[model samples]
Target: MKRRDAYLKLTRHNGRAGTHGTYNPKHNDRSFNLANSEHIDPERAKGNIYWDCFYGFRSALAPQDPDDLAATFSEVERQFYESRYSNFVESQNERNAKIRHTERNRSIPDLLSSRKTCPEETIYQLGTLDEHASGEVLLAVVTEFIEEFKARFGDHVHVLDWALHLDESTPHIHERHVFDCENKHGEVAPQQEKALEALGFELPDPGKPLSRRNNRKITFDTACRKMLFEIAKRHGLELEEEAEYGNREYLEKQDFILAKQKEQLAAQQNKLDELTLKVNDMETLIDEVSAAAYDKAVEVVTDVVRTETRKEDMRMIEDTKKWVLSPERKAPQSTREYTAKHLDSVLGQVPQDHADHRCPLAGEAPEAGSPAERQGADQGKSTGFCSATAEPLAGRADPTKAICAAYRRKIRKLFSIIVRGDVY
Candidate 1:
């Protein structure tokens, strides 16, 4: 196996780009870019790791989305104000004509940038692209390192989030935390030196006063780096601790260049994603509008067809009724012949009113001098008899009324068939 170098870089956040979007990505939107399909391989995203232990320190008023370092710092500042600085603020307001703003009236992020506070960030890797450790082994070692760090510094340092990015060329971890300790007012405030001191970290050179190269922070980082190497050893990982001269700066410069490139690419991808979302939304809206319009058109057509069909049917029924009842008009010869044959049966089946106790043909005055009229006159009978039955017609109503009713029924049946598309 190739021997890998154990790497850890501690940082305090500046105004530069951050790692939150790259850590937890909502890929469907533009919330994240570098961690999306454009820069990070989508197929490999499943192997990425995210572990967040910031819930214990998250404020109730914090944003619901993924935590950023700014929000984390704000929470720390809020804790200091609520627990330690509130009383002092109240007393100052009561005593002075010029009231002091709440919680020192300062921004935590500004103080952090100025080095008045510390926001701890560390990126750990066990290998380089050319000679990297196996992902399984690296993960195991990093897991142990995280547990050890938390156990050692839980009292003063709080872990916000940690992400292991496997989609990149090599596996590595980005962990963030904030160091805090009680101040003179007995209120816990974010202060890196006091917290490291509380954790028993001493200056690198005991004989010298605290300075940039001999600070407790340097001592703390050295101890953490040593712990990481020890954990890797237990996991059977061979890592080099000593760095060659000038190698550290070169690697850092390379890392910085790569980061800026990714940021530019991310910016481009974000614009593309926004445009895609707008196009998709417009497509969905058009489809809905088209469907609604189509349904309304169908409804209007159906209503118009139904109204016109009812009117036409009524006109046809009225015309047929007039022809059958008219003494001067007659049906076609074929229709008359068929009707003549079925007339008796049709007459018997039609509904009758018992109150009309008269001849079936009595209601219709036949053409003068017709056979039925002559027969009635010759027989000296006031009522007409059916020509089909040749018997005295009583209690049966008008034949014309029955014939029109039967014709109306047939016409309605035919209209129903036409409406159902069974007939043209």
Candidate 2:
């Protein structure tokens, strides 16, 4: 027998109606026959007859079985009694199927994924009992909630969709929010509290009056952006506008500093180039002077050699040779020859009557004075030669003295020429 049939039999033996004794064709339990009870004594089956009569009357009135009733009529009794369990199961199955279909078509998972990654807040207004409340008032309440949510969730909460479904008699808004659960740590509420604190507002107790709280009201349109701003402010997040301005200022300052540095570097390089050019010019001049001196030295040496080989003035030539080769000589041979030739060249350039030749010992024209004149007089008495206009012969015992004196005079003249800018 089916479980329902067995249940029906047990209820009948206990003198009770199966499903309140109402007949239903769709019911799994077998219907009881009222005529079968007539074969038994009424006195011996009074309890069965009483229950049958009651069920017979109820079936005639209602015309539906209690066990096979629809959900609305059956749920209360079926919930506790477990008599209408199959019907409940069928209803639950229908509900689950509908939910599954809706979820699949809507692509809830994909929507959730998108919301998780998006960095924006979702806002919505909650319905209250007040029907006459302004839209602004509704928005203000929602804005407060948004601020609280931001403080609690920090960067974790992202609002995806928000809509005020005001067509209903009791207007309310739907909101979709996403949390970056993997990135955020700890409880969300505490973080929200911190955010509110930063905004100079304390978390309000739900029971508190709106006027007592620091609640500012706003309309739906006004509330959207304001809610975002409040949330971002509480969490110390930067808005696109502020960040862009900051970046621009930073770049301008950096550019100014770079331009100044470049200018300074260019100036320094210019100065260095100028100094280098001056140094190069000075070095070139020094090299030219040195080479000229070397050539003049070679010329003087050649002249001395020629004079000695020709034997025109053996005594003076021999003395010159001795001076050139002497160990006691302070100057090198090259230096000595260079000085003699240089002096000869300068003397050759000067006129013969130039005062440089007046005294054999005089290196230059003697300063016009008493002491030099007396010295010249004494020298003249010893040498028996006039102090002025008297050229010493090459064969003299001390020919070098005359040459050296002439060389000194020539040097003084050359220095004077250089200082006077005549050499250029």
Clashes found in each candidate (C-alpha, N, C closer than 3 A):
0, 7
TM-score of 1: 0.43
Global lDDT scores for all candidate models: 0.53, 0.36
**lDDT assessment of candidate 2:** 0.36
Candidate 1: C-alpha lDDT = 0.53
Model 1: per-residue Cα lDDT over 10-128, one tens digit each: 22122212554122212211125454356666566556665555343222233335645433434533454345435544444454535544544444434344435434456676666
User: In angstroms, what RMSD does candidate 2 have relative to the true structure?
Assistant: 34.7
RMSD of 1: 22.4
lDDT (Cα, tens digit) per residue for candidate 2, span 222-252:
3445555554344333333221122244344
Q: How many clashing pairs in candidate 1? A: 0
